[model samples]
Target: MFPADFAYVRARTLDEALDLLDEAHAADQEAKLIAGGQSLLPMMKLRLAAPQVLIDIADLPELRRGGWMSSVVGGSFGGSIGALSTYRQLGRDALLNGGVIRGRNENVAPHRAEGVPAITDVLTVLADPQVRARGTIGGAVAHGDPASDLPAVLLALNAVLTIASRKGRHPESHLGPYTPRRTRKEPLNIGKREIALDDFLQGIYTTDLADDEIITHIRISHQGGTASAYEKFPHPASHLPLAGVAVVLTYKGGRLTDSNGHVTDLADGSLASAAIAVTGISPRPYRARAAEALLKDAFPTQETLAAAAAQVTTESPGSANRVSLLGDQHASADYRAHLAEVLTRRALAKAIARGGRSL
Candidate 1:
């Protein structure tokens, strides 16, 4: 399948890309930003998307740089991953793979008990080496594929996205909490807006991104003692998840110590917070708030985990309403619902185990 004829424009810098997008907007011409082209190229070849102009920004340094970034506060760790960071880059990142994070005060670096298992697990099974090498994290998010693995993990982790656009034009509004990081100076500057990943993804192949805007970074914060993991059932041929679940859990309470000062297994603790997100079963990946409500303040027992898993597809916090799920020849609605429940249970168990008895 040959793609429709389109003009290709390679952007020299981030600003140059924004300017090109702005020009396209003014002329009412369709323009799409291309990075790894792992997502767009396929759609273009199938004639699913036929934009008039394609702006290449794969070589922009600002979009390619990423690593452990300082958190907004002390005694915690967070990351500001460049949107264009590929799956391979993320898989090898030390901080994200359970390495010790050195704070500004070098003497008191915090050790992450469990690195973000959700991300690492996704990278391991996302696709073949070829796709993982060329697919950009930002592109995957921006593309908003409903069955994609990473977005569900981001939703569970409560990740934030930094969006950029030309000055004088504000990012879209009424999409959850908005955090703006820019000055009001009257110069030709860039406008940066931060939005929760939950609100950013609206539906299948749809997002809150404006035509003139580009995703700059995906930021995540991990507090001490928090744990997370992802579990999925992928289709045999494509390796895309048939049903995927990501769980992030936080616990409150201290470990028990015996008279000899040895830690015991009798520590009393309760869940402080729980974020459960599921994908591949619905029109869009969604947070399993009903399941979260069930786990909040509860002990992480096998029974409790099972009870919460049963509600992964439930719509309300305390009701029997189920979400409208997607069904196809690959998996029926009933089968997907079943997979969501089973995978959610496994994900919660894995995350709890990662936290150990201390959690």
Candidate 2:
């Protein structure tokens, strides 16, 4: 099913895209932005997104141009990751995908781990090099597909998004934070306000986005010494994750203090901070806090799967176990959940292993 006829606009500058966004939003409130047209165009071809206008922004300087090529990290104890990184690129640099991958590959860059098993899985999930090459990090985040891998990766990595309008630029935000009770007001909602990393991105195929908002840039920090992982339950039909999970763990190491003047080999990296982000289970990427606490305490194990399953349900109380196949064959939502649980355990395990015996 081809898309209905629509006006097309090729934006050359940031201002042009912003102006087009305003016009489109005013006219129909559902116009789509095309970056690389990798994701959007196909959706258009299938009539999944029938925007009245297509504003191609892949050519825009802001989204197309990569910054200076320079390595930010280096040392004997802690090595450096080279520039222009990709999941495949990191593997070329000897980065581990998770030491254990639960699913197949999505060969584009989720860029979650410097090198981890989950990263390679995500690269493969995104499919052939041709599609991955044309895909833009900014487009995926803005598209905010719930089943999409990068949304989960960005949420876990605390990747910040920038939105530009006629009013200049403002921070992008998402919605979410599930609770124990169904009675409490859901805390995930974005508004005409400044959004921080922790509070953005609410649920699957959902966001705090407005009709006029256009995503401009993505901001992620290179510090934090985070040991990270990504996991996905990819569809047999599409190879896109039915559910995806990502994790970041920080640990500290130093000389031991005297306890009764005795020192022993409990010397390993002590988890300093930890964050778990899960996609596919909910409307948006959500922090798996309970699973995080368990992983933080015990690292990854078979038991960790139980803890994650518990917490993931907390975020997605309304998910259906049934499958709504788009074609002849596909995976059910329940199967996806099971897959997510598998990836969660592996990703957490991988990050912890990377933490190693730091102390």
Candidate 3:
């Protein structure tokens, strides 16, 4: 739509999109995928991200739909993601939809449930109503924009990304040797299958999107055995979190669960595992595993929680936006780190409480 002289081609379905791409550029790498146009258009307009050809994958119903997808940890498949789902759509699917922090209609309530706390509390700061209306979860994720909130959440959730091209498919019949436990919801996908989140995501704005290939879906899970939480420092003007953290824990206490299971007693299991994914402070979301190790086995208490909160950051933090609170505003990186630690402690305490505070 800008000064770029790129050709626009719309396909009615995902297969068609892939087929068209396959035909146009069998081995070429100049085609770009267009879904909601929220991420693509902006970059195009600014001339920061322009492609010679815009392949519209919006028409794919598979991308727009939902499906059941999950696999056993240390077993087989991981999860699947339907390509077309937008954040708005996934936000309303009833399964994933709940108390949104800042949704225009019904808010997705942030809750500490099953095993871990919810990040819906941070959603209110993602963006304005108008911007949200147009943004898709897929778009936000595919772009891998460091500043985006949902992207970091997905990372902490350990979300798996699905990609496909007219050229080839993934290990359809066999999941790789490594199968991480389901820490989030099972991904529902259309094209290829779910690859581990680490394997699925290549890098910042750079992925394994093959020639004429695009991401079809993403799947995440926080099944039983995992407790998690999210916290964010938002930008007042855009509601975007300058720093966000998503924590996922694998508790063997037989207490930690997800949106579907029940909480029991930690004494029932004897061991636990937990991890945190962080964003807004780095180029991409990162895990706060080192901080988590400090809380494991340590019975979650107010004091311990506070102590744990102090350890949220071991790495240097990025810059806060040029804004003020009352007169001059600046939530120093140290403050954000402290806040992240606090949220982590709260979420962990909640998890321990659900387990009867029994170490």
Off by over 4 Å in 2: 25-30, 65-121, 169-199, 254-267, 297-310, 316-329, 356-359
On the 0 to 100 scale, the lDDT of residue 194 in model 3 is 46
RMSD (CA, Å), each prediction: 4.2, 10.5, 9.4
TM-score of 1: 0.88
- How well is each residue in 1-359 modelled by candidate 2, as lDDT tens digits? 67778888898866677778888777765677776676777878898778888887756654433322212232111222211133344333333342322223465323333443444556766656766766666666666666677666656656655444554334332332211121132122211233443454654445655666666545444333567767776667776766778877765444555968775555254565567777765555566665566556454445654675455544433443322211223555566556666777777776667656321
Ranking by TM-score, best first? 1, 3, 2
lDDT of 3 by residue, 1-359 (tens): 56477888989866677777766675564778787787788788989876888888777765665454322232112344566765555555432432222323454333322322444544455666666666777778767665577766677677777665543445441354323232233232223444655454444566444565567667766564454456666777756566666655554543466677866565543335556666655455566655666666655556756765565665422322311111114456556655566656665665555444444
lDDT of 1 at 260: 94
Model 3 misplaced stretches (Cα beyond 4 Å): 1-3, 23-29, 69-79, 98-119, 169-193, 224-228, 249-271, 306-311, 315-359
Which of the two, 1 or 2, has more TM-score? 1
Best by lDDT: 1
TM-score each candidate: 0.88, 0.69, 0.70
> Which model, 1 or 3, shows the larger TM-score?
1
* Whole-model lDDT, model 2: 0.55
Better of 2 and 3 by lDDT: 3
TM-score, structure 2 vs. true:
0.69
Q: Output the lDDT of residue 82, model 2.
A: 19
lDDT of 1 at 12: 78
